[model samples]
Target: MDTRPRRRRWPIVAAGVAAFTASAAIFSQIAFAATLFSDNFEDGDLGGWSKSGGTWAVVSDGSKALNQSNSGSENAREFAGDTGWTNYTVSARVKPTSLPGNGLAGLLARAKSSTTFYRLALVPGGVQLQAVNSGSVTVLGQVSRTVSTGTWYTLSLTVSGSTISGAVDGASVGSGSSSVASSGRIGVQTAYAAASFDDVTVSDTAGPAPTTTGPTPTKSPTPTKSPTPTPTSGGGGSTPTGSWPSSTGSVSVSGTIKVSGSLDGGMKRYCCIGDGSQSESQDPMFELADGATLKNVIIGSPAGDGVHCLGRCTIQNVWWEDVGEDAATFLGTSGGDSYVIGGGARSASDKVFQHNGNGTVHISGFYASDIGKLYRGCGNCTNHYERHVTVDNVLLNKAKYVVGINTNWGDTATLTRVVVQSSSGIHVCAEYTGVAKGSEPKYLGDGMGDGHCNFTSSDITYK
Candidate 1:
């Protein structure tokens, strides 16, 4: 889904080690501790590091360094070292290649997991010191600083006791406290950005004292400020009103909200978390039970896997300002019907709607722009469910394909009135031969129109 698209232990450090020599006790001997681990990438291998999302490789940026090239990846992390690493200083040279809108890149430390850690990220808010727990970010401290592209900067993060502090190029990034992540691993990360990292090193130490800087003012991007969903005229045939929604307020969703009956967001914006990044294991923002309904909600940035229709559900007039992983996924197999009516999604690096469940996903009056595929039937679900999708009167802007179906799995995609530009180079219907799990689906072709495609030449109107 190009979708474009850590540290080691040391001895002698007196702080945050479970078992060590007599002098290697706890925080008592931090001053005596020296360098424990270091990596420059000249060896051209990510040996001890574990990666999550993003296309990473060893490249020469001045000298040999590790680079993460997938700018669009969310929360791309490369972790190394021991998980029991507590009270340590992790430092590295970071140079961002790109930072799209809300993108961020930098070093990490005390990472309890790929999702939780203390980081010194170069982001829109400048260099930040924050505690990220399961993707729920809490800014412990921040300092307004310039983060120009292609400029190599020295970033350092240290975690000791409850204090988590960071710095960039020797200037203090401020500090914060977090008891939740008292001890963990060390690593590097990027969110919707690409960066090269080198000269990574760790020692038993803590950062400087927290600076006295006040919280810097920041602004959130308004990417999907429109898509005012009109009431569905005929269940799923309401046109998107181009007017973006002005949020009444915002709610940071740390965990998935289970909807057993129905819940209305009252025009509120909810978002920015999933357990991890673009992986299949990401938690959805909202998880609907069998026969549930979610409506009038605006999904904000870093939307974790969007919504999940577990059985059969109705997603009506919902607008996704920024999609994560995918806008929404229909977990099939109940043979129950799911309806996506009168909503719009934008900035979906992958499919806007994923049909992995059995039954049919009836999508109408929906609008998707800046997307890879508007609707995709699971090509290798392993369950071999016959997923079907019907997209009608959907406006696809700057899309790669309107719908992609796996014909071998008896998947069907019926698209009608798909509005797009003639020269957009967008595919109408792409057919693929489904494969078993762990294999990529073979591309059969595009627009065969046969039974699986089920569309005519005039079905798509070139505006």
Candidate 2:
């Protein structure tokens, strides 16, 4: 059952043609230090900042307003240039008026798109850190540091490695961390609320920031199955070699091989082998090659699990559609890092598509529907020793059960800048020593629940 709704890409408009190329150059001049990246909202030229097409309106205050009222947008600031900063800090001063339905204002870091990135916003109610992986956006942390509506408030956001910390009015409000493999562009954002931004800046907080070298593009590996010879038997002649037959194929794998096809037709038997235990055994159509970095691949199937992994793999810009069960299932028998980056899975059942063995699982920019369990660790399964699983910029549209993180057997998992719109059951659950406890997860905007999870012990801001 395809649970994914047809998504409409929001059109963005660049306000003024004032390209602040000097902003990046200024930052680089200061040893790539922090530098302002705005049009100063002084001149009518809003630099390159844009709005979500006409979703928001821009107005100027005729009177002497903060940062020259004639400059800032009326409602919200939209996406802009791709300021490539791997590890840096972004801060802005915003004066928010009446709280919009989705009131928000802040700096957007590692922004691949308007819907996928890390956002640090300050509302009339509080401050929040959110990430949008795929279509799902998760609120990693939030604090009740209320800001007076229509008043100017300085918001500072810092991102180093996988951790993002935020402060309001120079006071540390909320902070959290997650695993982000790649660096993305930056921008500012506002919902359906009027806000004014001033002194927007981006700079390296730690040592020298990495240069904005374009992303290294990788090719999708050609999928190959195990070369098991077919035998002529009573079932149905000889089973096809390399390809699994839906009627009478047996499942067996000797090693691992790159996968590139779908088993739309039901398969009775399937197996694939690679070099020295890099093996993958699955009964589904798609199989991710071990240690293969995949980019821009689509997995389409009919009411079945997408890919079941028996080894480690790295996937990026991948999409799974119409999966009966989970999209991608991982059984870490070999014990290595398995990653899923920038993709969504639409499933009929619980979207518990990706499971982890003892290996680490890092998911960024992922969206799913009815996610039963994002990452499930087997009982006492530590072949690779699962350390940390980070999910960044993940959004769950409709989850009847647990939405965020659900680990059965004790495995450390981190949900950063994540958002869940509507959920019918708990948000997060973890089972350690046969005892599961954590915040009672609920629908969107609900505060954190009390439980026996590490999140409760930490200083996590919830709205």
Candidate 3:
């Protein structure tokens, strides 16, 4: 009896291989090393690539390319190449055909697995660089740039030592660093977005360094300081006050802290936080590291995600209003436990909770309104147990979608005493039905066990 769980085998179709190699007849100006892996998708198949999530197919018509139209959290990666290389560059031509409200399509490098990788995401209005270790996502760098949908752009990331630099087209965007995992696989990923990738190339060879005139200082966005978190009477450690640019402000303590006043932000949403040495226009209001507890705090008028929870975090009795995006976004690795209890939110510009990576999320007594989805899963995923979601005594008012389990495959979600008073009723699996659009469909049936959602409630109302 093999007690090991059986992995599902996906169908791989053969595609036609093209015949256009680099002809020696054309003299090269720059001497480059041997290509590590190159796929034009002319073969019309994902012959050597393995997918962690999403339904991918080699589209042969019009032009040969690897297409991922499946919604939810899906990433297709190639695992045969060298995962131990120290210095290498991964490049791809990406085109986002369609995007969801908060969709992201990007390339992955140094992927130790599906969940741990250095990702360069092309978001709706900007680009983001994230370092995901196991399930913890650290925003290495982020910058806002106008990205036109349905347009193809060439993107690349070069990792040499601790520094990871990203470029789009031919211009430099930003860079971030991570001392975690050094090397892994390279791949493509999308969340609630339809995208096609072509001319995928990975080269360990070094390219000629461009001529630099001088040290051109990268301009930071318009600075808007966050309100100081006032320390109440109870907590032991001194509350960290003063205005910091981003959520990189560190806080370490054992007890709870109260944010007595509202921290207000502007309308411009930032893509990524600079390395914290520079001022930022839009960033998470508070950056909570591992083992932090925040209580009775209010975040207002945030242009980006409100709180970024890294490790085991408990946020209770918190409220958010006029938030630009997710009120609280959790990105924890190391099997961290994230809890949001006894909170109320209103006038949310987007969803209330954006839970990603690998963590056990317990959300209860949260009343959110004028928002999108109340809960979403695995915006960025890992091979580890995606996220164990538990929702109890939650009320959603006039939200677009209720709950979404957007794991790679067979995500587990549990709901009890969850009520919704919206025109769309209670959406059990909104990611599959809405993003997948029935092409390669996923659904919620039965209860919670292998591709099913466990939902038990009778108080849901719609008018």
Candidate 4:
């Protein structure tokens, strides 16, 4: 009599095996097969690394090297089991030093179980590529410059076949292509900042190379009408109008198309349409094989001010209730990546992300009830770039005057297992002249009422 559905157990701390032939004599002459983990904060053998519950510190890098600190500000640095390989390639050299707002250094790939993972951070301001499945967080890439706090920087990641390329000191910024599940296990992430990782390596390559960029030429221009308006047998349905395939032009649809209407201002209500007006071919909605899902949708009014998603789209289990002002907006002039898995929105007054120039908005398993504000760029709006908003397993109930989750701009939001019982649970408007001012929303989570939660947001980090 086991009716299933009862699995939420977490508590496994086992990571003490650093004997790779004694650091393989210090990187074994570095050529390919590599592995090295350190923390001279005191003891040695952190080879299998483990320290994620409370006061974390391996400090003591005044000379001999080995660091990880968090005296009182919440901490994290996990490295569970080693999910093996599927065309691997991981490298590190980090050095994050005095971090408080730009603190994060990375390399956590394919980690399927231990709450899932796929990070690649290195922040000072630049290089970041995340993917913490199951538990949320899905920022695929970032590279706005900043990367020089205490020195050292040589991060590298390579997951062949489904893409996932990354390189820092050597060059190559970020790359993506995922089937969603490749192979897992691999860690080393730092959040309250304070970093110093050296050598560390993981092997296996030859994967990544399977897109000749062929067939994908339709040029979109057919919708003279038919935006989906013929379901009378279904009572409440009637708000289908179409016309958008002119600007940069791009519209792809492989299947699934069910729009009950409600997207007048967000402009044309596209289930698939690109050319929002060139920030790199604006309006882009791509879902090739086994991708593309939008149900009971509504993105009311958005004519020449928002909505831009370049490639790779996913808006599953949808429902954007009454989105008129701004319910979904993500712009990337020369960069791209947008994903919104599982949706639910109520009122959207003006901010959900306005002038996102660089591009990146990942809201996992979302549920926004009364959002009047939640943004990245509103300061009069310009080319405004740099954004990586990840809200996994979210639930923002009754958000009156909400603002914090990644305010101001330069964005990098990550809230796992989130639950903002908002009267106002996060507000930040300091940068571009108070953007649009809307304060009195601060709640970092500790109310502990079993909303099934997790938190991360001095900027975000909880690998």
The lDDT leader among the candidates is 1
Every model's Cα RMSD, please?
A: 19.0, 19.9, 17.7, 21.2
Best by TM-score: 1
- Give the whole-model CA lDDT for all candidates, comma-separated: 0.74, 0.49, 0.59, 0.46
- The per-residue C-alpha lDDT of model 1 at residue 134 equals 38
TM-scores for the candidates: 0.49, 0.38, 0.45, 0.26
Estimate the overall C-alpha local distance difference test score of candidate 4: 0.46
Worst lDDT window (10 residues) for model 3? 236-245
How much is 395 displaced in model 1, in angstroms? 0.9
lDDT of 1: 0.74
RMSD of 3: 17.7
Which segments of model 1 are wrong by more than 4 Å?
1-237
Model 2 CA deviation exceeding 4 Å by range:
1-36, 50-58, 62-77, 100-102, 208-463
lDDT per residue for candidate 1 within 361-442, as digits (tens), equals 8888887778898888888876666567778887777889888887644456767777884327787889887778889989
Error of 1 at 207 (Å): 89
Q: What's the CA error at residue 88 for candidate 1, in Å?
A: 80
Query: Per-residue lDDT of 116-170 in model 3, one digit per residue for the tens?
Result: 5777888887776677644456666666777777788898877767777777776
lDDT of 4 at 347: 62
C-alpha positional error of residue 437 in candidate 2 after TM-score superposition, expressed in Å: 47
Clashing pairs in 3: 15-43, 16-43, 115-382, 142-272
